[model samples]
Every structure is written in structure tokens, then in C-alpha cells.
Target: MKTDDPTMLAAHDWDFPVPIAYGPGRLAEMGRRCIELGIRNPLIVTDRGSRDLPFIGQLQSLLENEGLSATIFSDISPNPVDSEIGLGRKAFRAGGHDAVIAIGGGSAMDGGKAICLTANNDHDLWAFEFEQPVPVIGQGENFPALITIPTTAGTGAETESTAMVTHADKGMKFCVWHPDLKPALALLDPELTVGLPRTLTAWTGADALVHAIEAYLVPGFNPLCDGLALEGLALIAKWLPVAVDEPQNLTARGGMLVGSSLAGIAFLKGLGMVHAISHMVGAEFNTQHGLTNAILLPVVLRFNLPGQEEKVRRMAQAMDLSDTSVEGFIAAVETMLDQTEIPKSLGEIGVPADCAARIADKALKDSAARTNPRVATQAEVQAMIEKAIAHAR
Candidate 1:
């Protein structure tokens, strides 16, 4: 896993944050990892939608059979809020849980991380916002060990040190970053994603594609991240459609899992306008993260194309598009979107026209937007939002 790229060497110190075990059925070893982490009692955090699923139930049973007591907390929502984190902390303390096993998609994993970071800290979770980076966890002592199991092929939340949490009153998204928030281990079991619906598979996979594309085009591209971004983009291009068309395709699923993880790693270097805008829309409209990302992908690409033409051309080459033009790559992305049945516009997702200006204003301030190749103004962001809405129509 050594890379010799100078940019990567300069941008990052080549640190792999967590121990990752990736395979088709690695989830079966969760009990052993929990024991190795010295957890006799573990709280399993997941979303309500995934609590009763076969995978969660099976993991719970496996842990119980191994003589580990487990408590399940499934009250988290799609965009986890501070209240949910508080509730999870309460549950953890009540159950006397020693460690956490986050066993679902991004929300569950993030919620679990939030609980772990704040379990010993007395301040509210919002105090750890990414903007100020103060009141940092792991400031004085070690945090609890966490194990993550992602049931989706997107969001890469399991690998990163930050969790995107929604502010309850502000109705906006903020990040909680702490070194301790990084999982002690990530068990990527592609088998857990096989039963996902086609729409979800397409949406999440498209989100991964955006992550790679954005990372590749971000202003501070480093060789290490660029290589990962390029490979991730290629993998998604080759495998996402297959996974969408055939959910049971194990090979396709595996490719997607790897692509998603690579995308996560790449974004650690930087994300861009697509995530910035998508987060605003998602928080405001309660839209699906991946689907919103899919709808906004081409528009953001087009908007950034003026400044990112060279990068887009490079991405086109990686995607095997013969034309090597920004428009060529954009067209290729459009074709992929069409093939996956991803919506072409924001209107399709119930994002109202009137809200466009507000979303733009917020997106202009998003942390991800700052890394975009072309730093956009509020007016420009509004225009792009309008374009996305019209395209969706």
C-alpha cells in the first residue's frame, strides 16, 4: 500500500486511520473483534430501518452466542441530530456498554461515533464542530473503541474521522471531527449490501462516484489521493451499473465496496461543491444523500468545468472516454445517470424553486465548497441550483 507520488507525500503522511478487514462475509467475525477490543458489553447502534434486518439480528445473535452481552439502539434517523447522540449516550451509560458496534449505513455509523466521542465528555456534541476544532475529543484521554459495519456501498463514513450531523434548531449540517471518532476497525462485508433495493444501490454508488470525481478535481490534489480517486472513479464506472442492474452480482458488489472505501480515502484529501450543495439540499429538503448527489453531479461538473477542464479531461481519460474533453466526461456521466434511472433534476426530489436561493447561500458557506476548483459565489451557486432544479424537471 505504498505510493510514491510526491503530491500525496506532501498532502498526507500516509496514515491509514483504522484497521480494515474487507470481504464478503467478514461481519461474522464481529464478535471476535469486539472481544479483542476488550468489550464484554457492547451497544449496537443502527437506524430503525435496519434494526430488525436479518444481518443485524444475525450479528446480535453471534455476539450473544459468544458470551458477549449486547444492547441495541435503533432510534437514529437518516440525518442524525444532537438529540439522538444524547439519547445514544444515555443508552450506552444505562447498558454499561464498553464499546460500540455501528451496524448500518452512514447515519448509524456516525451516530455511533458521536456517542462514543461524547460518552466521557461533559459538553454538548455540537461543541466539536469542524469550523472551530476546539473542545476536541481525545484531548486528555483515550476514547472508547468502535467497530463499524457499513451496510451500504457509499458514504465511507466508517473510515473517516468526521461525522456529518444535523443541527436541530438551525436545520443545517455540521461535522464532528475527532481522532478518536475513527473506528478501531471497519468490517466491510459486501454480502450485507446484496439485499439493498436497486434504487438505493444506484444512488449510493453514484454518491461514491461523486466523491471520487470531486476529490480528483479538488484544488489541493495530492498524488496519493489522486491515485485513489482515479482508481475509485474507474471502479465505480465499471461496476456501479452492473451492481444496479444485478443486485445479486457478488463481483459487482465487491467492486463497489472497494470503490466506496477508496472514495472515502480520497475525500480525506478534500471534497468539493457537489458535497457542499448536496448537504444543504439534503438537510433542507430531507432528500436522500446519494440521490441528491446523483442529481447534482452533472450540474456541479458543468459549473466547475470552466476551471476544472484539465482535471475533467484527465477524469475522462480515466473513465475511458475517448474524447478527453470536459463535456465528454460530463456526457458520459449523464449516460451513466440515465442508465441507472437516477433522476435528472432536483425537482424530481421535491426541491422547490423558491428554496433555491437559500440553499445556494448556505452551500456557498459549506466547507466542501471551499475546496472546489472554481470557488463559487452565492450568485453562482444559486444559478447552479436553478440549473439542477430545471434539469430535474
Candidate 2:
């Protein structure tokens, strides 16, 4: 029995930064995964609009079928605010939830992540906004196990450890981060994303595009993120318009989902001005984050990519554009905007052009702004915002 065999190979395990169970019907595996995570009592956090959706009930029944308890906390709104997550933390604690099963777009996913962050921590939520020396996040049950099922491809909140929640007192969206907030698993079931409203499809796709572009352009030395961003850009470029026109095209949906996730991972290298500008605007206007990004993308790109012709050429190649110049890449972006019917100006989306100064001040303070290739001033940010307001008007 002790014979030494030279060819013996032991079984091994493989995992990514966040393990993803991806496909059309991966939602079916949720129950077993919950068990594996020791999540018998889970709180399902979602946005207000997603509460009545069929998948909510489907997931509930699926969990119940496994003898697990599923309670929904859909009090969150778009651009989720502090009060909502405060209430969610209360619900999670009161319900004795062992985990959070967050399902929906960015707001819900981000809210769930925030809830997980504040659920057991004694410090006030705002006190934890990412700082020089990160707070010691207690492990084990102090942080609830999280499983994210993203219904939208934008934000990539599922894969990231950061969540942007509005601080009601300041009326600002703060990026609060902790590594433990990333989900134990991300279920990317394209079937869930299919049939998304037309506007959302376009807007969220643009959000992914911005993530890829900004991640690539940010002053960075990470070749890994650069490669992922290019691939993500290619996928988004190819599939976004098709998804918009076709709606139920599984292939397009799957491509967007994968591309969006890649952008999510890529931006760990950090994002740039488009996100810096959009974050402040989204908080102030209560606008869709993706829509705001989509409108502001071209204007920000015109500013960031002008002197960088070599970078623009690579971006052009990734998008399969023939011209391979900064001008040509922008033309392609404009054409995409037109094809998807994205509003050309932030003004068209009810964002008042008058608040440029206020938005600029807040945007300059945003962490993303620091990573932008250009050292933009308050005046510069305001000018950019104003130009984006009148971009097509």
C-alpha cells in the first residue's frame, strides 16, 4: 500500500478574484452555491423597480426549495442613498441573514455591498470612505457572505469591492471600499439580462464602454488591465448596437455581459475623467449613471485622447475601425450614440447646465479624477461639463 508512484497527481482547485458562474441558466445553480457558502438565511437586496420582477420570485422559490430562507429588501433606489442601505443593514441584522443575494443593476448591487460593509461594523458608514490606511474589516460572520447576480452589464459592481453610495448630508456619492465586499460568487446569467428595456441596454452598454476606455487611458503601467480593457472594448463595440436593436439576442447579451465584467476587472487599474464627471452628476441629478456616462463620453474623450495618437491607434484597432486616428475613433463613438439613440447632451437628460461649477468642485474631489491622464483644473472640469451639456445641442 506504500508503493511510491512517481506519476501520482493530486486533485487541485482553481478560482479567480471573484468566482463567476456564467451562462444563460446559471441562475439554476444558486441554491447549491448558497449552501456551499453556508448561507441558509439570506437577504435578497434589489432596487424598487426590480421588486415585482419575475426573477425575484423565481430566485425566492429556488432558495426556499433548498430549505433556505430568502427575504427581500428592495428599498433601494437608483443612485442608492445612505438611508436605504442603513435600512438594509437593519433588515439584514434583524432577519439574522447569513448572506446577501444581491440581484439587479448597479444600484442594487452597490447597495448590497454597502449593506455588507456597514452591517456589522461599528463605525458610521461615511467614516469608511476609502482612505490612506483602510479600516480593519473583521472577518468571519462580521461580514455577510455576498452573492451577486447582475441584471445589468454596467458598473461591474458584482466583481468590484467598491460601492458608491450617496451621503445624504452632503448630497454626494462616496466611494466606500473594502476587499471583503466582493461577492463570493457572481452569477452572470444572460437570460436575466435579456429583454432589458431599450434605453437601459444602450445606456449600460455605453457605461461598459467608458469603463474599458477610461481604464485603458488612465495613467497606468499594468499590462494585464490594458489587455483586458482592449478585449472588453472590442466586445462592447461589436455587440452593444446589436443588443439595442435586437433586444433578445442571446449572443449579443452574453457578449455584453462578458465585456462588462471584463471592464469591471480592468477598472481595478483605476478609471478616469468620464467616471469622475459622471459620479458627481449622477449624485446631483439622480440620473442613470450609465446614461450620464454615455452623454459625457465623447466630450471627455476629445479632451483626454487628443495628444495621444499612438494610444488612439490601439483603441481604433480594438474597435475594428478603419481610420485608426483619434478623430475616426470619436466618429465611431458618435455613430454608436446615434445608432443607440443616446441623447447627445446632458442638457437633454434634464441636467441643468447652470450647475457646472458645483459639479466641477465635487468632481475634482472624486478619486477617479486623480487618475485621469490630464491634470484638469476646476476651470477645466467646468469647461468640459459645459461643453458636454451643449455637445450636440
346: Cα error in model 1, Å: 1.0
Q: RMSD, each candidate, Å? A: 5.2, 7.1
Q: Give the TM-score of candidate 1.
A: 0.93
Query: How well does each candidate superpose onto the true structure, as a TM-score?
Result: 0.93, 0.94
Q: Mind giving the per-residue lDDT tens digits that candidate 2 earns over 149-261?
A: 99987877787668888888897888987765667888888889886999999999999999999999988589989998999998889888888988987778888888898
Which 10-residue span in candidate 2 carries the lowest summed lDDT?
A: 5-14
How many steric clashes between backbone atoms does each model show? Answer: 2, 0
Misplaced by over 4 Å in model 2 are 1-14, 139-141
RMSD of 1: 5.2
